[model samples]
Target: MLNIADTLHDWCRAARPFALATVVQVSGSAPLPVGTALAVDGDGNVVGSVSGGCVEAAVYELCQEVLKGDAPPTRARFGYSDDDAFAVGLTCGGELDVLVQRIDPADQPHLTAALGEVTSGRPVAVAQIVDGPEGLLGRTLSVSGDGSTEAGAGGGEEWEAVAAAQAGALLRAGRTGRVEVGGDAATCPERLSVLVHTHASRPRMLIFGAVDFAGALSEIGRFLGYRVTVCDARPVFATAARFPHADEVVADWPHRYLAATEVDARTAVCVLTHDAKFDVPLLRLALGLPVGYVGAMGSRRTHTQRLELLRTAAVPEEHLARLHSPIGLDLGAHTPEETALSIAAEITAHTHGGSGAPLSWSTGPIHRRQSAAR
Candidate 1:
């Protein structure tokens, strides 16, 4: 799975044989989404999780069976409800389709190459034949954004092409899931299901101030899996020693650097400089871009003044509406750590399409759309 590729690669490098159980599909209210994995080594060591602790024992047992050669790579489904006969069901009343397959030490070298792409901030997709003819089971192929591919043994050239094409399609769209391939005259001619899992680099978070609050927020952003960059015009304040958690520290005017930066819909821009000269120009550029979230730190009075300056600068009303001034949720935070937590919470909610409402006030599946699979 993409989330555990680092751990899996390490195990392979150590020449340890392991069985990887991946949740390939789900329905109803599931505990985890597709591409989630749970691995068990020969010594019974485990890494990552699939069911948030609900159905791990069952998945672990299945991994053990695969490790012992008692079974081939197999697809399994688990479902439980309040009235089910078996006691082993997701407490959330969801169903999960899991695939368990053994990994050999010889396959590690090939896999490590793919992992390198992911850790180096490139987009990659790994396609595994989870269900098909006997000969194709457990076969895998990885495709990166540069159109390079890596395939495991036992896969024919024709099948590799088909899988790579499908993986490339998903990679372009930045998606992960199972796709039906083959059955065509030029290919295997027998339809098969391939689980195409994609791994994209972490999202970017650009903080436009190097204050104490910036350091705290950078730490929280890193913990939340964001590539944080702290930028300011002052080099003295924007030092690696000052903000160790930030992935980069740029000593340039916020507007000048952001104008040349590439941002997609997943990028978040936080204007924490709080000065009219810096905040006005930076917000003017950020609000026009197609970013996920754009928030500025200021009091009510300061926000009001900034709005007037933005309006005078010809910023559209629609763009102005996208700004979240007086940034962060109303957690009544005063300390740097507390304020950082509040801001990170707001960013998380915004990225995941959450309402920032209390869970007790919400009703429905908790994981309704928590993952990128959908």
Candidate 2:
């Protein structure tokens, strides 16, 4: 699985055989989502998790069974039991459909290559036949972001081609889900259910300031699985030592650095430099970009002044409205750490379309289905 690709690749390179238990489907309020995987090697060593400790021991035993030579690829389901509190199931009132399959680098070369691509930060997707005919079970179709595809041994070429195309579409959308293939079609007679798992590079978090708040925000960004970069015009303040959590520290003008950096719809831009000289140019450009979030830190008075300056500079009213001036939610935060939390909360709420209100005040489900692009 891409979540633990580095460790799996290491085990693979060492010629160690292992069994992977992947969560193919989830129902109800589950802790983990689909494509979450747990791997167990021949020596009883484990690398990843499927249910976040709720059903790990049972999955581990399933992995051991899969590791046996005579074992075939299998599926197992775990859910809460109203009558049996001691039963091996999820106590969180959720259901997980897990597929256990043995993986040997020599046998599953496509999977090994996919794992390597994931570790190298390249986009890759893998489609595995989780439910299908006995002969098709465990067969895989690997698709790269560049449109290249490979199929495992012993599957109908037409079926593999269709599966590969579906995998590529899911990969482009950055989603991990299921696709129904085969069955009374021209491709193949046997019906098959495939789980397509996409592995994309981490989203970017561009923090445009070298202040203490920027340092704290960078730490939170990294914890949220972002590839954080801190940039500032002041070379002395932008040193890596000042922001140890940032993946990159650039001593360049914020506007210039942002102009040269690659950003997508998932990128988050934070302008912590409240000064007019830095904030005007940077916020002007950031608000016009296609990034998911663009927030600037400042007081109400400063925000009014910045808006006037931007308006004078010919920035459109629509673009100016996109700016989250005086950034972060109203958390009554004063310390840098608490301020970072507020900013992170705002960014998350924006990304997930949350109301920025307390969950207790809402009546609907706590978790909303996220978009594939997110």
- Predicted model with the maximum lDDT: 2
Q: What do the candidate models score in CA lDDT, each in turn?
A: 0.86, 0.87
Cand. 1 Cα-lDDT: 0.86
TM-score of each: 0.84, 0.84
C-alpha positional error of residue 253 in candidate 2 after TM-score superposition, expressed in Å: 3.1
Measured with C-alpha atoms, the lDDT of residue 43 in candidate 1 is 92
Residue pairs with clashing backbones, model 1: none
Candidate 1 has a TM-score of: 0.84
lDDT of 2: 0.87
Cα lDDT, model 1, residue 37: 92
lDDT of 2 by residue, 1-374 (tens): 77889989988888899999998877776678778899999999998899889889999988998898858889999999889856888787778799998988777777788889998889999998889877678778799989899766654466788788888888876678788888866886778888888997788999998999999999999999899999999999999999999999999999999989999877999999999899888888888898889999999999999999999989999998888879999999999999999999999999879989997897744556434322
